[model samples]
Structures are given as structure tokens and as C-alpha cells.
Target: MDFRRTSTALTREQKLAVVSVADVKAQERITNSYEDALIGQYIEAAYDYLAGPDGWLGRCCLLEETFEAYIPNPGGGFELPIRPVVDLSSITGFEVSDGAGGYDPVSAALYAKSVNEGFGYILHSGQSSWPISIGVDPRRYKVTFKAGFGAADDVPSPIKLGIIMLASHFYQNREATFSDNRITAVSRQIEFGLRNLCGRYRISRDHS
Candidate 1:
């Protein structure tokens, strides 16, 4: 996934600070353009993997996007998915369309005060009938929302540290992998370190 933040969470100076390398020429061994690019790549990858609709760990912010949810046709009625959504900061818009081509905006009065529980929402106004779309459309309901911690500063300390640690590890071991693509000790160490941070914001099995 493409990250909204274009640069690494940790700055070049910050990476150098982490390793205590002050000389510009010596630091170029790890802070060159190619290495800087790799560091940024790893930072985004870690952020994406940890702050998830899938994996769990980091905090994110200033994100806004639209998502679609398909209403399932059961013999009884429509059912929404109960899984914990990833990085769903807030649901700003909820609208539905009729199978034929008409659309209607769902009123907030029909549901609770917009509380997001377990990354999903449940209407509390006792209304069960939502907009429906028939035929082959998988997503009849559209939701626009934002996710993340709010800004880079708001990200948890552990997650930021994890990103720094992992990026530094990769930066130091440019040739950690072999021609056969074998993982190196440095890679394993960073991977192991990341595991320690993965559970920070994990969704529980019983989340509601």
C-alpha cells in the first residue's frame, strides 16, 4: 500500500543519531540516497503492516479515504461483516443505493452517536433495514472515513522506535541477503524485534 507520508518516520539525522555516527562522510556509508530510500521503504512497510486491518502494532493519523462494504443477502436479511476493520479512524459518511440506481444518504439519527467499536459499527436506533443493492455489486454501502493517530508526533513511542530500530538494522546490513535470497542474522534480529511491538494495538478476538 502507498503511505500518505512520503518520507521515513525517522529523519536522516535521527538515524545517524541512533547509531551515534556524527561524521558526514562516514555517515554516508549508511545515509546515501540509496540507503535513505531503503530506510523510507522499510519505515512505510513496517507502519503498514503494524497499523492494520490485518496486522497490528503502530499508530497512524491524518488519513482520509472512502471504503465500500457489501451487504450480504441472507434468507433472513442483510448482514454486515463483524471483523475488526484496520486503521478505521472514523466513519464520516454512510450512504446506500437501491439496486435499481437510486441512492440515499443514511441519516446519523438512525444510528448511535458514531461510536466505532472493534473497528465496526452497529446502529443503535433499532433500525435494521439499511440501503440495499442487488445483482452483482459486492459493495452497496459506501463509507468515507479517516484513520490513524492524527499525526506523526501522535504515533506511539514504541512503534516509532520499532521503525527506527528496524530501519537502522537494514541500513547497516546492505548485503544481509545472499544471491539465493536467504535472510541474514540482521534481518532475523529486526524481524524478532518487530514481533515485540506487533501486539501493541492488536484487535482482540472478543472485540465488539
Candidate 2:
């Protein structure tokens, strides 16, 4: 099984800020906007560190995003790589004829989607199974879908708070490491706190 993001045009607007600049300032107890720009950078950095497939959470947080999954000779059913699937756009099976690839769109009536825990699965609608591929193409089966928690407001409070905490930590500590050893302990504490808040939502690599 192979899974990859099909949509490459994710706009900055769609990558919604999990926490606002005002939110970060409030967390850090900043009175003025003297360093608002720097704080904003911290917010973006924090968001990047904790969101999407490459982030610590290994899951989309702010909004739904499209992804494509491929399965070779899928059986009765197969799991969707991304969790909490918002929608299943389409499913296609590849057919080989005379040493050429042909498209075979799986009809909606032949399959159904079910969410178990956070994982999404494409199951046969009735007792029937998925069509088998004729060749050795790895991309025999294709599934396109969108997955995410929804919008910024739909994101869990703990995740929002975690982003704020991380950004605040970045603001407080300008340098990666201070000469004083005490700051290291503080950084570790903050790291652990962020993990505790966002850990449960993190998707395990094994799931991928």
C-alpha cells in the first residue's frame, strides 16, 4: 500500500493559524506589539512543527486536505492512510489490456466507507469484493479523499493551547540554548507540556 498527498496547492489561507498573534501575546503576557512580527514568526513555526503529515501530530488540524492512496490488488476492503476522513472523493482501479494501462472507476454503489476509531476504510457495499488488478502495477488501486478535523474553530482546545504554549516558549527564549543550564530544564518542561496536550491526537507512524 502506498499513500501520498495529491493536492500540492495548499494556500497560506487554508493553512489556518491555529492560534492568533493576539492569542500568543496573551499567553506570554505581552503588553505591547513591539515584537508582533517576531511573535508571528514563532506562531508559524509552532504551527509547522505540530500540524500536517510532516508535523509532530502526523495529522491535519486546521482544515481538510486532499490525499491519494494506492493499493495493489486490494481485497474486500482497505484502510485510508489519513485519519478522520472528511470525504471520499473517488476510487479507481487500474486495468491492464494489451500491455497498456486503462482506467476503471469503481462505482459508488459497489463500495462503502466506514470509520473505525480514527481510521477510514473502503469496504465492499454488500458481500462482494474489490476488483483484482491484472498486472503488477503498484498503483493498481487509487482512492482520493479529504481528511482533517475541519476549520480553526473545529480544532480541539488542547491543540490550540499547545500551539500557543510552543509559540510563547519560542518568544521567551530567543536563542535555541542559553548559556545557563537552568533554561534547558525549562525548555524540557515546556516540551513535555506540549506533548501531553497534543500527544493523544498524534497519529502513529505504524498507522501510515
Candidate 3:
């Protein structure tokens, strides 16, 4: 449905409509959902980087040895800083704990999540996984594919060329200037990566 475009000027109060707390929370959820999905993408990319041509699952444990701080989003939500575990050099004793405890799991988990989201930047050329073409300004393309997956309730990643075209906008912009395809593909990759991660999540396996 087309929203009516009103150019009429409104008072400051009218312009600044107060959003209810519920609405704010809902918006936060949506934003966080996207960010959470993005995190998955970073994880996949990092995992791929660590794994190379061979399967990624086997090398996940290496990250634990290099445990580091988690990096949060620019504003809020996540709260982990980026730091290699190697940089940490202040341990005085080496007692054996019941559980294989080394660096903080919570922080490491978050860091691993972020790296997964950074994968899109790595696989999106005209040759990697998808032969999807992207112009200098990819916002102009009309293809879509997901480099990762999000929550379990999340929808399936659209890998079809038709969906990719539609998502990228075979003809128009859905959200911003970034080709509709790019966003959709990016979203799909993130969702698929995370969704399929249950049995094969790199971080968990590595840490375990």
C-alpha cells in the first residue's frame, strides 16, 4: 500500500510523535534481530578464514587458544570488545578446573558471532559461492542470497535467482540504495549460516 505523501508542515510536537515504550522495544527487537543475523555472517567468514579449503568444523577449536574480547555493535546490544586471547598475558597460576575453562566463554562467543557476520565481504564477488554480479555500486543489482541464517523461527534463505532478483529489486529499491539483491543475499547468507549452525557451529565445537 502506498502511504500518502504530505508535504504540509506540522508543529514540532506533531513532528516529534512520541513512540511508546512497547514500540521502542519492538523496534529494538527488529534491529537487534538484524544485528544478530549480521553476527552470524561474521562468524561464517571468520570460520572460513580459519578453516581455509578444508571443512571449517575441525579448526574451530583454534579460536579458543587465541581467545579474545568480543566487539559490540557501534551503539549497543552486544558488548564484547575485539582482542586476541594471545594478547592476554597476566595469568599467574595454572590450576586444572573441572570444566575446560580458559578465557571468558561469554565474551568469546560474542566475538565468534561477530566474525561470522563479516563473511559477506569475503564471498560476494562474481566468482565465490554465488556467481552473482555486483556493480561498482552494488545497490544497482537485482539478485539476492543469504550468506548466513538467524533464529530457528527464521524463514528459509532465498537462494533462487528469481527471489534474488526480486529481493535485490528487479526494478525498485526496498529499503535503501544497496541493491535489493545485495541486502537479500546478505540476509539469506546470514540466516542460512546461523540456522544450519546447530549441529556444526564452529565456536561451540572448538571451545568444547
Q: Find the candidate with the highest lDDT and give its number.
A: 2
Total clashes in model 1, counting residue pairs 3 or more apart in sequence or in different chains: 5
Question: All candidates' TM-scores?
Answer: 0.57, 0.81, 0.17
- The best candidate by TM-score is 2
lDDT of 2 by residue, 4-67 (tens): 8776655544433557888988887899989987887887888888877778887553466667
lDDT of each structure?
Answer: 0.45, 0.71, 0.26
**Model 1 weakest 10-residue run by lDDT:** 74-83
Instruction: Write model 1 residue lDDT over 43-146, tens digit each, in one string.
Output: 55544555444445422221222334444322232212322233334555556666566556766655542334325453446556544455655445544444
Candidate 2, run of 10 with poorest lDDT: 90-99
Tens-digit lDDT track of model 3 for 1-208: 0111122322222211211222332423433444443333333333333331133332222221221221211112221211111211211111111122322212222211222322211112222222222333212111111222221122122211112222222113324545454787766764464435422343332244
Higher-scoring candidate on TM-score, 1 or 2: 2
The C-alpha local distance difference test score for the whole of candidate 3 amounts to 0.26
**CA RMSD (A), model 3:** 23.8
